[model samples]
Target: MGSGESTTRKVSFGVDDEDRVRILRGIKLSEDVLQRMRGVANIPPESSSSRQQTILKDELAKMAEREREAAREELVKTMSRERQQARKEAEKAKELAQQLQKKDSQLKALDAFYKEQLAQLEQRVRHSHMFHRPAETCLNVKNQSRNTAPVCPGLQAQILSCYKDNKDQTLNCSDLVKEYMQCINAAKKLFCLLINSEYDLNCISIAVSM
Candidate 1:
């Protein structure tokens, strides 16, 4: 009798546990259905019928579409902001490049001007060396090289060409003569300054005059 009673009690306990679980599951499903209805139209759920489910699905679909549209709008706004920022940075970089190019051009121009001045200075030095040679020294040089070759072959060639080209009237070659006289005068001035003043002072004086 006691064994039968114990077996009966165990069977009844298991059945009660199963029933409790089924009741909890039913309550959970009901809450889920209500929550879904409130999420779309905030309408209270009446029953778990197929019609009610269909209405909830339609509203949910509309809500999903609205969410998708809002997300798309947000995405577009984000992309536009990025594009604007990129454009601004590109403009900034372009302006910087232009500034650098302008600076480079200015530097090149100054370099060219400096090179021209240096060339002029070197020419003046060569002319001064030539002109500082006395007329007697030039004559001696000419006599010494007479049997060999021209002392200044290039200069002699130029003068000879000019004279030949204008043999009819010497006046046509007067320009060459004027250039030679100018060199001679410059040589005389440099020589006089060297003999009269200190070297550094003479250079400063020459720069001032120029």
Candidate 2:
């Protein structure tokens, strides 16, 4: 009976040792699973923060590009306005130059016309002086010789009358001047013939008396 009780106690001890090994293995596996779950949970927050930073950077870049485009558009508009204003000013200057040139031409034409009129008046005055001196000499010669017929008396009277009627237009007496010249020439020829005839008569009378 002693031997059998010893054998039974050994069998009980072996069964208790096998149950402790299984329990230890189960506890180790549970700890490994809990650690892996904690690692998965921590990774998500870091990844989400990185994604938010990328989105913010993209928005800032887009805003900068829009500002640059607006600045370029404004510069183009300002340049266009300046060019239009310059063109208008140039056109106005050209028009003013044309007006000044036209006025200068008109002034030159007027000056030439006035100068021509003055020259004509001076020539007329000289002609008047030439005729007046010859008329006065003829009158004196006529006063000294009352016995001889006055040379060109009627034509001289007509010339004087024409001059009186048209004081400013002395050229009106051209026909009277021509008649007076012809009368003077005829009178000179007649005077020469009369002098020759008188000399011949005197010679005849002296010879007959002798």
Candidate 3:
């Protein structure tokens, strides 16, 4: 009576081919277990074997369906977790790429700024050097003037006196002017000779020290 009621309760089970196969396999496995149990225990003649077999098939099919459902739910959860993990990884990669791009842009900006500064400094230096040349030449002229020996005052005086005396007849001062020029030339030559001699003496003294 109990076996017949259980078969009636779970008779509607499989529809598709895979479900049918599972039902058939579950039935066979359950039948094997039943046969083993029957061997161990004495069979009661009142209980129908065919009715018991039908009840076992139905129960085993239901058990297989529940296990398949649980496996599908576990698979769905695993896929969902993998998808979430992949999304998080993608977001991290995108953020890292953006950071790298920002750093590269900053480096480029700094390079351009330094290059512009270097160019400006070079231009200022060029202008400074250009303006300094005339100042340096003026300084050199001042130094030369300071170092020069004075003219022959006696010769200059004679020329001036002659010119004043012959103011009404300027040609009479010509000889005196010529003599003054010769004296000035001779003095310049003597001064240059003395400077060269002194330079040579200094060189000789340095050589002796060495």
Candidate 3 wrongly placed segments (more than 4 Å): 1-48, 117-210
How many backbone collisions does model 1 have?
0
What residue runs in model 1 are displaced by over 4 Å at the alpha carbon?
1-49, 120-210
Clashes of 2: 0
Clashes of each: 0, 0, 0
Looking at candidate 1, what is the lDDT of residue 192? Answer: 39
- Highest lDDT, which number? 3
* Model 2, position 121: C-alpha lDDT score: 34
TM-score of each: 0.34, 0.35, 0.33
lDDT (Cα, tens digit) per residue for candidate 1, span 1-210: 755654332211111442321332212334445446447434555667978899999999999999999999999999999999999999999999999999888867755654454455446545544433432322323422212222333443454576667554444545554454455455444543544443544444443444
After superposition, candidate 2 runs with Cα above 4 Å error: 1-33, 38-60, 117-210
Query: Model 2, range 84-142, lDDT digits (tens) per residue?
Result: 99999999999999999998778667545544543553354344333222222233233
TM-score of structure candidate 2: 0.35
